[model samples]
Target chain A: MDDMTTKDVQEPYTKHLLHYFDGTSRYVLIKDEEVPFPEGKLIVSRTDLQGIITHCNQAFIEMSGYTEEELIGQPHYILRHPDMPKVAFKDAWDTVGSGVKWHGYVKNLRKDGRYYWVYATIILNIRDGKPVSCTSVRRKPSRTQVDACTALYAKLRQAEEE
Target chain B: MRYVMTVSPDFPPGQIAGWYIFNTWLQRQLGEHIHVELYSDFEAQRKAIREGQIDLIYANPFDAAMLVREEGFTAIAAPLSKPDEAVIAVAVDSPIQQVADLKPGTRIAATDDPDVNLISMIMLEPADLSAQNTQTQTVGTYILVAKQVLQGKADVGFFLKDAFAGLSGMIQRQLRVLVRSEIHVIRHVLLVGPRLRERHGDLWNLLSEMGENDKGRDALKNLGLQGWEMQTQEDTEFMIDLMDTLVN
Candidate 1:
């Protein structure tokens, strides 16, 4: 096992490691800063097999409040907020699963039970033959705007859980 | 030289009467030798301006405001037309009868253009009407929204009075205006390129000096103008104010 150094794990290079994933063949960098991601801003990552997180940057860990020890073995949904509707995530997965980038707003919960919003750009990672990991970035949301969104997410989550 | 003047598709295109006529009349009156081509849509017109493919333009007030503010274009004149207003509408039999009637959960078919419809909604009335519990689903356009309302697909819709006027009689009959906005000046402004300012000072002078009887009067009339009038930055501050208020 190649131990990836924190410096080596930093962006502008960590993305290259995705090529080492089993059956991984290609990667795409989804870029956008429009909605203010706040915790160092950019979300650069790679994945393998059914949209899994193969590599993420320090910014991702800080924004998500997850230690690398806990994040490595888990799917991204560990951060999913109870307030978020499963359908939104379903749609996001379905979209990227089809091998295209989808741009939209997402409501997520932090490790502390606090909620955050992100203007997300999700891309499909295709290996030589299959999907591996899915990655995302989240940022703070404007309080004034998120009230309506929060309410909507509550309803969506209710429907999903039902 | 020949110049193309791009206008919004909100109105008809081509060499029709009203504003375009006035613009043509003004161009000939300036007599520095110029031709004006008219484009009916703002997107196409804006592309022309961005590409430096056109030397002059007659843009919608919002588009003009952006050009003046962002691109440093100079405004030679703006039509005297009153600003276009919008109306939030619901089915005639719907329970929504007033602005206060809207709740947060209400599904409103609105355009994705935040600057125009969404910001305008906030500027016109800044309240958590949605707090009462309603949702706003942004649709592609007002026309699709109108169809949605008619087919009972949406609870409410927002539309410009001018645009709603042209909808089919069947759809028109199904809707009722719940609230109409305060009159806003959606003027058609004539602007010169920034690079042309010094070399075209004489042309601007000609424009500023031309009167109703000037040969350009026909073009001016086509463009829906009475005559050219000079305006300072202060003249357009209200638009900036509206934009700033919405953005903030």
Candidate 2:
């Protein structure tokens, strides 16, 4: 049994270092724990078109398990969970690239190898009819919606791998 | 104060000339006491919203959702449209039958409207046609996309189902549906600003009930839409979920 604990991960801020193990190497971190979302709070971040973080709020920094300095220049996908299907991101890019707002449930991996679910609202900042950047506002997702998305994402992943 | 209303330029500048005529009739029905003016520029509409100068607006589902969520506006009603109502079309004689048949060099045409462009991109996903792979021509309107495909200027076109359904017989005969997207999105929507809803709920109710009433039905017919129906919680939620999945 892998008994990696938070204390064991002395260098928790390192990008590729891990403190949790899910028994499978497919994911960078283990989903051994779930993070609790704060009530009536929002996790907010802004990214360039390539998804390099430009700015993020304190709540986003706290929930993401990354310090503000570590997150600012990093790609937003650093927190992506392996369980997510590529199709969802494809649809999101297609929608937002065309200058429309997109909403979806996302499961994000934490720096400590835990995970949390959020209902994310992403809007592209349009300048001269083209997207210059994107802003995302995230709130805690309902259990029902999370369960529904998990099943749907599993199906999508199966179809994708085939 | 006169209420400000804006329309999306989903249709080309002069093609749907009836829109100007229809909004004029709608303003009269809303009563001269509630003066309404119509404009179609999206940038101008965004400006008005940013400045809190607009009162009511008729917009695509994406804009309507954003306005309601971020701009102190509320969705009151949406036009009657099927959830998954966008269709990709090709010339009837073309060999392209399914999404996989689309090649790297194939010419794609779509309206400049954001909804149409996004739906077309989503529809093309199955073919793995990314920005690096395929090219797109932004035609002025849905009708022009159909015309472009039919005239062999483009290999495939994207348009709303209603636009294709209302095309001229000859043009309709020349095009065939390549695929219909499975993603459901709301069509046009009606939204009222916060002040309008707070201080003039009765007036707002009167406008909202127009679709179910007699005079409102006439205006709807002229506008080429069913009467406005109240936006349900389920509908708003669906759009919100769809918005995240469909972003570029």
Q: How much lDDT does each candidate structure score?
A: 0.55, 0.68
Which stretch of 10 consecutive residues in model 2 chain B shows the poorest summed lDDT? B32-41
Model 1 DockQ reads 0.01
Q: Best candidate, lDDT-wise?
A: 2
Q: Can you write out model 1's per-residue Cα lDDT over B127-198, one digit (the tens) per residue?
A: 244323556666665788787787787777877665677677888898997766543443455677765566
Docking class of 2: incorrect
Question: In model 1, how large is the Cα lDDT of residue A35?
Answer: 28
Model 1 chain A lowest lDDT segment of ten: A26-35
Instruction: Indicate the worst ten consecutive residues by lDDT in candidate 2 chain A.
Output: A18-27
Best model per DockQ: 2
Per-residue CA lDDT of model 1 for A8-29, tens digit only, reads 2233332222232234333222
Residue-level error in angstroms, candidate 1, position A101: 34
